[model samples]
Target: MFNGLSAFPLTPMNETGVDEQAFTRLVENLVLANVSSIGALGSTGSYAYLSRTERQRVAQIAVECAGEIPVMVSIGAVRTRDVLDLAEDAQQVGVKALLLPPMSYQKLTDEDVYSLYQAVTSNISVPLCVYDNPGTTHFEFNDELHGRIAHLPWVGSIKIPGVSVVPDEAKARVDRLRAVIPKHVTIGVSGDTLAATGLNAGCEAWYSVMGGLFPNTAKIMTDTALTGNAAEATRLSRRLEPLWALFRDCGGSLRVIATAAELRQFTTTPSLPLPLRTFTGETRQRIAAVIDELELS
Candidate 1:
């Protein structure tokens, strides 16, 4: 049921634990912006970094704040059993769907990946979405594996992160996946910078990080692209280029978005777990310049 921009918000954290007030505000912001769906605890949400209780709290808050908008909770974990447990917990909290990435400490084989999904889908009553984010999981899904995953019972959609830096090449990959995957299964694209090209390539939904902070802007771009308004979509994409560049230079969107959120006073500067650095002063200034230039602040 993820058909348009599904906002993947960063889980706002404070010293003690999840900043529940800030997290609720962020989710409410997405709903107010009318995002197609809310993806709680996705990569952007730092699912792996949070404890089970923290994640459950995040999911519950998102579902509570989302109102009519669907909430998709990421149930991915290093172990299949943990994934299944998360899936069950999500169901209890009235989650709309489960997003599972094939995660492992060591490299995983195709069969291993397939088995992990199979185990969860077989147990969970809710629909499951395959999240193939090679950048985070270090596991890639080939075309054959995609076809097989799409055929699995209860699997509804696949989130493919746009890997190619070239626009045409990224589109080509989306086209190829669309051709092979089951017609019933929707192909959603991630990678906010390439999202316009991906939507133009016929991806039905966008699993977006930027959308979490600026859903209205993302919705306009995706809607324009989906409706064949190429010129309008191109303009919107160009407008977002500076922010996208900061995302790349800062290493990821988590810190950049968190910093933006803090600047806007949406939330306090979150305390990320150790080993994950906050944005540098120079980077924050650059981000501030882009935000001001875009009139996002």
Candidate 2:
């Protein structure tokens, strides 16, 4: 379950609250696409912006819709107590795993993060994936710190950030970390644009935001790479470079994906949470143009 494409869907919302119907459609689509697993309430899902009640509801919805497909729910919160509470909530809904990042207001030391993982892993019922998304949480995980956390029981995977795009460098990066962490714990790649590079470099999984939006496209690239056809996988990924460029120009993936989701009718327009606006005017036009040019559905 942790070894292949893990698609993370956006948690759709409207003026009222969680858009249960649309969220359901997203999860069902992933199930149909036959993704390796579904990661709910991930950064892609806007977990940090939601209230605890909303997060729990989303977790229940994901697991209920996923059926036999593994569901990994994010349990990252500001406080350890709330993270534990979320872990219990997710497990209660039968989520196969949990995704956690060291969310903190103050700068966290290596000891702080290691201890955080130790506390959460102590009583968790399912496997946990360490979400090392430095872009949002602002807490970076060094290889040594990841090794320390991976030593804890139930720490089954580490979701590292993007590696160098160059194949050899990317492989070296994965190999370096592979040496430090326990052999049983898998290393997954996060950055969507770098996924082909990461996986071709021998990373075990692709924890992908784009995969959530377009699972078939992701499945094709992932399948091709895993089969040892690196050139075709790189070709497939390069084909989406325009979409990735939009992500860079339009201020990260959240809004750009929200736009794509809206265009694709997977969610209502303006699906993002409060204060975070979706793209508009020229930017939206460009996104739509790229979508058409790439024949993205």
Candidate 3:
């Protein structure tokens, strides 16, 4: 059922760039945390910035370190052809699954979305997990879209950002969607704050940026939540709330990734893609203070 925590680790980069050694360390650390699964080239891995060759190399490295744990590669792109190419390449990499979301405002109709999904599914043999973050795609996969896509044999999961302007509203939407979707297909929450809520609402899996920084603790919290211990899950989540706040307050995805790497001491030098700026000195201190206040190393 793809139950439990899946840490989406950042693909670390060093002086020479694409620090394979650091990446291996990152993988080994998460493996020791006993993560049920790991995703490569997802948002945290900076997939949108990496060249196709770089993505392939990182996917191979992730698969090598993944061991028996399932590894899923995010194969999304601005173009459908490129998305399918990545999926085909991922199938060759032996990933347990592949995820792709429509991008570049590419589709205006259900037919367009379905055709895009059909092409990727036809090309890839492994299970397909749909990445449904409208925050990036500028397109939301409504319930009808989800029901249509969920019927595909290879479509095994859906990953959606659990963020909302109003918590109650978010819960209502998730609950409604849960009622319609089949119980077999895994529903994964993307953010830490929504992990407990999503699970309580019937989500079976979660992928988190905070998990990448603190894999063991994330696993513990997720395991507790899945076992129906809402009290314990709430306690553990309170501890993570500060960090999640930092991720949100720090402003953008690049800052979140850079701040996480900096806090964890993953790499001395971290870089974010263009059209994004690095964290300021004050913001870094604020992030550090939150970590210290939470007593999280």
Candidate 4:
């Protein structure tokens, strides 16, 4: 299922087209790291920047490479038709699940979000995971909104990013959600720092972009934490903190993945979409020091 450490890999592209070779390599590395699952076309994958056909091709390749491992396709577009189309494409390619965010760049009421989920569920057969990423989607989904949406039969999980934007707001929100959300439906915390706390508080899984950098380390941390081995988990978590910090101190998911790739040598070019720079020289130097200090590579 999606209820574990899901490594969201960056969708690799080069001058030719969607780089299937790199995509294959990334998937192979993640499976070897013992990741519970993989999500293609995620925030780290630059989902928004990819073309419709490219997204479909990447999804197919992910499924092919994963073989038995589950593959989650992040499908959220402006038009409901487009979303359905992508979902159908993914389902055809044997994707295990779909992760959808609310419509972006527009104001959507609770009803609007619900309707989108309903439309997706009615058409798509696989499980649907709703991502409540207000940081990017700009739609702050409170408990009531999420509760209503979760009632839909196909809804599987909710991905929430916990950060202290307001006074103790993140923890408060997590508490409320853990109380209200049905125990059957899983809640996955997105931030690395909050994973342990969220799991202790009721989060079933952690959707980690940081995991791509140090998947083996993350595997050790999550496995230990899940089993109540706090001391060992904390030790691994602290060891991973430096790499995580480098990613946190960045523009978005792409910057984080690029920085990690720079250290891990996952790809030759750690390029991000336009308007986002390739990280500063000072940041790069600091990241190198952190990687060397921690021996991340």
Q: Which candidate is the best by TM-score?
A: 2
RMSD of each: 1.4, 0.9, 2.3, 2.5
- Comparing 2 with 4 on TM-score, the higher-scoring candidate is 2
lDDT of 3 by residue, 23-129 (tens): 78778888888888888778877788788888888889989998988888889888888897788777778889887877775445778888888877777778888
Collision pairs in model 1: none
- 10 residues in a row with least lDDT, candidate 4: 162-171
Tens-digit lDDT track of model 2 for 106-180: 899999988889999997979999999999999978888988888899999999999998899999999999998
Q: Per-residue error at 68 for model 2, in Å? A: 1.0
Top-lDDT candidate index: 2
Q: In model 2, how large is the Cα lDDT of residue 65?
A: 98
**Which portions of model 1 show Cα errors greater than 4 Å?**
163-167
lDDT of 4 by residue, 1-297 (tens): 867688888766654566677778888888888788887888778778778898989899899888778999999887788899889888988999999998656799888888898888888788888888877788888888888778787788888886443325655766687676666678887877656656545566778776755677666667777787766765676676776677577645567567656556666564455554456578877866877787652
Using all chains and alpha carbons, the TM-scores for the candidates as numbered come to 0.96, 0.98, 0.91, 0.91
Total backbone collisions, model 4: 0
Backbone clashes for every candidate come to 0, 0, 0, 0
Candidate 3 stretches greater than 4 Å from native: 14-16, 105-107, 163-172, 252-254, 275-277
TM-score ranking from best candidate downward: 2, 1, 3, 4
TM-score of 1: 0.96
The residue pairs in collision within model 2 are none
